[model samples]
Target: MTNFDPAALPAAAFEPISELGPLSRERIKTRLDARGYNYAIDSDGDIGGRWDDHIFYFLLLGKDSEYLQVRGRWSRTLPASSLGQLLVLANEWNAGRIWPKAYVRTEENETLGVYCEHSVDYEPGLTDAQLDQHLGCAISTSLAFFSSLDEQFPEAVAAAKEEIARLTAEQQ
Candidate 1:
């Protein structure tokens, strides 16, 4: 894995996917569904929508706030592939902090990914440096999860990376 330093990344380069509007949503949903995710729009419409299957539930967010919340179920099977894709997509979406305190788990209930629900603190004096740090943390955590998956699952990881690159490129 490359040492991704958000500080080294150009501000223009790390464009947030949320700014892309509905098109971004469509693209993300399509990619997940193509990977065999059973996509669903949350009926309550509380935390945007969700794309889920027997494995993982990706809670999409619409705005930046401190008190974000998500309600869902964790799959008995670990959705490493889906989680990897979610991380890439969340990074693209500029999700400051992802929710649902716990999710990723091995068949034996061993946690393999960083699963936590916390605020992406935004304050008056927030700087680009701070934002970059947050982004770097999220990206690196996702990379770690991606690395944990078996090497044979290259297609899913590759596709997730490709989609992230494509979406990031479109923002430029």
Candidate 2:
């Protein structure tokens, strides 16, 4: 087995974070603020804000990595029993949308909520227009998913439970 060396990779494949990450963060903050979002910079240096009652946040997950992730959370907790239905919704939504992937998460107490996330990568670095487009996609997609789940989850969960019951009864 030969050792793999990233140094052998083309310099064009990587961009320095010092010039990109901080600038991008500042630009994102400035843009979001300009849009009238009141955000807080968290302890891990992530940005958190709210839009239309849903909480949204952004994080630069790595120093050398070009990925910037934005996430939005629904305001309501999903009942634990509805998690399977949430996964089904996420899977269905993911198949149709390329950005702001959907998810369901449970806390220690078993309260669950739906979330949507999108990761933007700057390889050679992004132009201001591209950055704006990516940010817009993130915010728009996240809100779209959040709105879908908020409006539809209860009925979907009921339908899922009914289907599960029917399947179980048929098996019996």
Candidate 3:
């Protein structure tokens, strides 16, 4: 037998998943793949991908995988000294927006890590359109929050601009 490489297959090669019901890892993978997003499945089976430098994970959690969560970690970290600033930013985002529940956590490295999550129970299952809306809203809202960070903490994220510019130039 030959070594099977899943990555070699075309996006269209995956089985058409028209009959959507419950939210499962495969459904998430199919949606991501169909949308041409680059993602990876971890050893624990969590599906994750990067967008504009931020990292997001699509997960189904529960005894029957009855819950769907799209969690994101902001790419920037601030010194613990900026805890107040981080908290204010998180609170502002939370107050103004609804899709992502944004917050900041004190990391072991003496820095503050930002996170955003959108989760819902899918006990009754979901249609493909519903899944698409959830996934799209999760990502777009999270990115909007990240962009707000870039705006509010420009000094902390200045390097991100340069790096993104470099990446964009390289793509051209």
lDDT of each: 0.41, 0.76, 0.88
TM-score of each: 0.27, 0.71, 0.80
**Candidate 2, 1-172: lDDT as tens digits:** 8898989999977765334333367877877766777889988778898787678887766676467788888766766988887898899999997878888889767878788898866655655566667777888888888778857766644554577689899999
Q: Which model, 1 or 3, shows the larger TM-score?
A: 3
Provide the clash count, candidate 2: 0
Models sorted by lDDT, best on top: 3, 2, 1
Best candidate (score: lDDT): 3
Model 2, TM vs. native: 0.71
Point out the higher-scoring one by lDDT: 2 or 3: 3
TM-score of 3: 0.80
Predicted candidate 3 versus true structure: per-residue lDDT over 1-172, tens digit per residue: 9899998999888765565487889888888888999999899989999998899999888889999999999988788998998889889888987779998998888988899999999997888888988999999999999888888888778766677889999999
Error of 1 at 131 (Å): 0.4
The CA root-mean-square deviation of candidate 1, after full C-alpha superposition on the true structure, stands at 15.1
Better of 2 and 3 by TM-score: 3
List ranges where model 2 is wrong by over 4 Å.
1-23, 154-172
lDDT of 1 by residue, 75-107 (tens): 223355466654554354345434323334343
